[model samples]
Target: MDIKNKVIVITGGGRGLGRAMALELAAKGAQLALADMNREDLDTTIGLCMEQGVIARGYVANVAVEADVEQLFQDVVSDFGALHGLINNAGITRDGLFIKAKDGKVVGKMSLEQWNQVVDVNQTGTFLCTREAACQMIELGNEGCIINISSVSRSGNMGQTNYTATKAAVEAMAVTWAKELARYGIRAASIAPGYIGTEMVMSMKPEALEKIASGIPAKRLGKPEEIARTVSFILENDYVNGRCIEVDGALRI
Candidate 1:
C-alpha cells in the first residue's frame, strides 16, 4: 500500500537507526508516532520530522513496559485515528562472554541481570509492542505491517549470548506473527542489520571499527539509510511477510 499519509508508530525512534528510519519515512510523507525512553533525543527526532513537513509526535515511553507500550498505541490511535504500520526498534545490549575466566577458573559469568536486561528490552519488549500494534490493527480492521529490527548476530555471536538469543527469537516471532496475523491483514517481518555506522557503533575506537568493517564484503559499515530503504520496500510490497531481510553487506556473524 502507499505509505503516504499513513500513520505508523516506531519504537526507539529517538536515535541511531531508528532515527534514520523515522526520517526516511517522513521523507516519504508518512505520518509518524515515535516512542523512546530518552525524551530529549526523541524531541530532536520529532523536530527533524517536523522540518520535513510530516505529521510527527513523540512519546516518552519504555517499550519493555507493557503499560507504557499500551499507552503508546492508545495515543497513536487517539491522535491519528488509524494505524498502518509499526517498527519494533527498541533494543539494548549487555555484551559479555558466556563465562569470564581467570587463571583457569571462572571469575564472572553472564549474570541473570545481564541476560534479563537484554531479553527484557529486546525480546519481551518487542513482544509487548508488537502485540499492542497488532491488537490495534486487528481491532480497527486495518491492513498493516510490523517490522522488527534484528541483527546479523541472530545466527549466534560470541560475547552476545543474550543479544543473539533475543534476535533469533525476534525473527521467530515475526514468522509466527506473520502466519497468525495474516488473517487479520497484518503482515510481520524483520530486518537483520550488519554493523551499521550509527552513533552507537561509531563511538567505538576507529581502529576497532576499521577491523570490523574490513571483515564485511562491502569493505564498509552499512549505513542506517540503507536499512531504511529496505523498510520502504517491505512496507510497499504487501506480499512480503514472514521473512528476515539481511542488510548486512554480505557479512556473516
Candidate 2:
C-alpha cells in the first residue's frame, strides 16, 4: 500500500477534492490517471502533477457510462502496465425538496429529471467505476484500494433526498465490497465529508455559508487538502478497509 510509484486512478480529478487528492498522491510519487468530463480542468491537474515530477495523464470520461468506465480502466492499464488504486470522486447534485412547498402548501414534487440525474451520476457512476476497478485488480492479481467519496448528507438532509439515498447506498456497498474482495487483496473504503469549502459551497448565499459554519463545531468550512490528507492516510494504512471516515469538523449533518 505504499503510494510511492503506485498507479492510481481518480475520477473527477479535474477540480475540487479530486484534484487535491491527485496532487497529494502525486507528491508521494504515485503515478496517476486523472479522469473527468472537463478536459480543461483535467489538463490543469495534469500540469500540476507533471511539475511535481510525477507520471500523470488525463482522460475525459463520463463515469455514468459503463462502457466509458471499462474503457478508462483499459486505457490506464495499457499505459501504466499495472493498476494499484482507484478513487471514485465524480458526483453531481440536483437539489430539491421531495415535495416542493409554496407558502407552506405543497405545490410540486421533485422533478423526475433531477432525481434521475443525481442517481445516475452519483450512484450508478460509483457502481460502474468500482466494478471496473475490482475487475482490473483481480485480473492483475495486485493488491489495490478503492475509495468512494460519500457525504455527511448520507445520513439525511433537507433538499437532498436523491443525494442522501445514493451516498448511503454507496457506503453500504463499500462495506460489502470489502467483505467480498478481501480474499483477493482488494480493499474498499469511503470518505464522508461535511460542509467542505469547495466551489459549490462558495457559491451558496453568504448567510447560508455562515449558518453552516456556525453549526460545525470547528466554526469554519473544511479545505479540500484536509480531505486529501485523509485519503493519503487511508492509502498508507493497509488495515483501514470497508470503513467510512468522516472528514467533517465534528459536524453531524
**CA-lDDT, candidates in order:** 0.93, 0.93
TM-score against native, each model: 0.98, 0.97
> Candidate 2, residue 67: CA error in Å?
1.1
Instruction: Write down the RMSD of candidate 1 (Cα, Å).
Output: 1.0
| Per-residue lDDT of candidate 2, residues 215-244 (tens digit) | 999999999999999999988999999999
> Model 2, residue 31: displacement in angstroms?
0.4
Clash pairs of candidate 2? none
Deviation from native of the Cα of residue 93 in model 2, angstroms: 0.2
Off by over 4 Å in 2: 102-105
Model 1, runs deviating above 4 Å? none
lDDT of 1 by residue, 1-253 (tens): 7999999898999999889999999999999999999999999999999999999999998888889889989999999999999999999999999998899999988999999999999999999999998899989988999999999999999999999999999999999999999999999999999999999889999999999988999999999999999999999999999999999999973
Please estimate how well model 1 matches the true structure, expressed as its whole-model Cα lDDT: 0.93
